[model samples]
Target: MSAPDVFAPARLGPVTLRNRTVKAATFEGRTPEGLVTDGLIDYHLAVARGGIGLTTVAYLSVAPEGRTHREVIVVGEHSLGGLTRLTDAIHETGAAVAAQVGHAGPVANGRSNGVKAIAASSMPSPLSMQMVKAATEADLTRVTKAYVAAARTLVRAGFDVLELHMAHSYLISSFLAPGLNRRKDGWAGSLENRARLGRQVARAVRDEVGDEVAVTAKVSLSDGFKGGVTTADGLAFAQLLEQDGTVDALQMSGGSSLMNPMYLFRGGAPVKEFAASMPLPVRLGMRTPVGRSFMKTYPFEEAYFRDKALQFRAGLSLPLMLLGGINRRDTMEQAMADGFDFVAMGRAVLREPDLVNRLQSERVESGVCIHCNRCMPTIYSGTRCPIIDLELAAHRDPLPQI
Candidate 1:
């Protein structure tokens, strides 16, 4: 009969979190040369200091060809120092740290990585306009090894959590979606077969990490496109993940950056703002009918994923993390009441890193992000809200560095 406490400490696998809030992974374009930077550490430090259970470092590519950007952090010897410092910095703030590891699949930027982007099958990427080649069996084996290696690296660097990314239409997500993964091989066709790569990665990472850290996964509840993975199938996939006995938790997310990104987070799409951040050619392309189709807007609401995530909670016994539209005490409380073990936030934390602290102290009702999604384009430059970082606005370049 009482509202569940959103700020109380909770168990997340091998670690005990200070609070139930998690700083969800957001791509920080600060990393250059596929290595860590002071900017990246500082970003997470702010979130950790603001008071959250864990802050996830975003999108570490397993292989160079899998990278969406040339400057994305690659789990390698060269990045050890930066990664260590990032974990140490978050730890100093008394917070757990996580790294999101995955291959970009068709989303891989051929212009940036100097290699043809890969997918479950040969298909042209709607976002990249690059033809993706089907990954060979050898490629899958190498990628699995890379996942294990990356998990080990994160644990060695003092991270408390490792989030295997199987969402957002990435390589793993592509395999899960029949629309993209048209292969007749063992890795395609049925949902069980399509989920093989993701399950393998989760299992490999869990095996490598042993018990040193919590291993979780992010899954797309829906591809938000027709003929894509359906909600019924997504629930089945979530059950499959738990049955696989690899990940400690399941985090729900959706939307395809290559298709309906607005579906991921229901909100206003800053089309002109996105176009303004690109080069002349890309800018012109954005103005075209085809380019304009990429930025479809969706209505914003608090706890947008609650209904869908609640279905997952009802069907599975594994701990689930509720994400999307968690910007206030009420929404966070709703998640806790609905049986989600943890709540993950991105734009809310980005706008106010201390939002968790504010919620705990009862200082603020909710975050003031406005759901404009103007900050979306800044991921290509540096992910800072235009409203909060005035300096960035003045120096906004015509072409954001890819």
Candidate 2:
């Protein structure tokens, strides 16, 4: 088959996106009360209006206890009304909507959540500075049910896609990583055992949604550290998903939200700025060498994950979306040429919500973003480009004299 057009319509399972450029999921930090707020709605509306083919609402927790923090929206009956409104607004802008659903696992903030976090093994949670409990068989069953419930809620909210988040060392991903999953049960040891949770969750969601919506997954291509999910293991798990015929596409990503987040981002880490965003006690700790080492920096490169994603592309027949450091039009077209079905962008679109439209019109200048990654720290407040906010502030009329 010929290479697909980057600017043309593309089908993601039952949903046909206006184009192949997706506004990749980024934690919006807008749902302060664990419910849909106006800020969350407007955050997606801006991206939808900016002409993204699909705008993904990030990190919606499958269960209340599964949240990364208390502020994350839990997909259930309580929040269904607000979620429906949010999706309706986005659809009106001619863009399809996706909700990224997952359990934070060891990555959850136990202190903020008022519940003990669960993981494949008992471990420390840096976010909550608390010990994470090893997930029991009962917990795993509950989580699978939670994923199914969330999938149904998303479909009812008029979402065109259900992006299962099985990456970033979240619940299912921790099970995949040998470093994190020390279980001696059927859910661990061998690759098939370790991969069981992710495959189970995907199949359950697919079964619940059926042909009503596109089902995709943000799959880990690597955990970016030795003893974590290696490239070989990641590729094998992706092929298994293909074999299961569950996900319509896989959005190949890297790094552990638990171990090494910068491995996926590939740019400046902005340690001090990140420190300032934390609480007083944690802020002081982040200044230490130990804290600095945890948030390590990686040099920036365009299409940083392309080489890794190609491995999965070669191994699986299913569609794949290449993510990480996709900023330029040429890069997007090059990805299509290289056999990727779509390109997903996060920071670049955060810098310019209308970037897809600008690239489509051939009016964009490349490298408009500096890749300093300062925007990442702002996820604690509201995810945005601080530079753009500054520029807009400067151009605004001066405040009236006190």
The top-ranked prediction according to TM-score is 2
lDDT digits (tens) for residues 64-113 of candidate 2: 77898889999999999999999999989999999999999988888888
Q: Tens-digit lDDT track for model 1 on 131-221?
A: 7799999999998998888777777788888888888778998898898888989999988999899888888887788788998999987
Kindly give the stretch of ten consecutive residues in candidate 1 with the minimal lDDT sum: 281-290
RMSD of each: 4.5, 1.7
- Record all residue pairs in model 1 with backbone atoms less than 3 Å apart, i.e. clashing: none
- For all predicted structures, in order, the TM-scores are 0.94, 0.96
What is candidate 1's local distance difference test score? 0.84
Off by over 4 Å in 1: 1-4, 279-291, 390-402
Q: What's the TM for model 2? A: 0.96
| Ten contiguous residues with the weakest lDDT in model 2 | 281-290
* Model 2: CA > 4 A from native: 281-290, 365-367, 397-402
TM-score of the candidate numbered 1? 0.94
Best by lDDT: 2
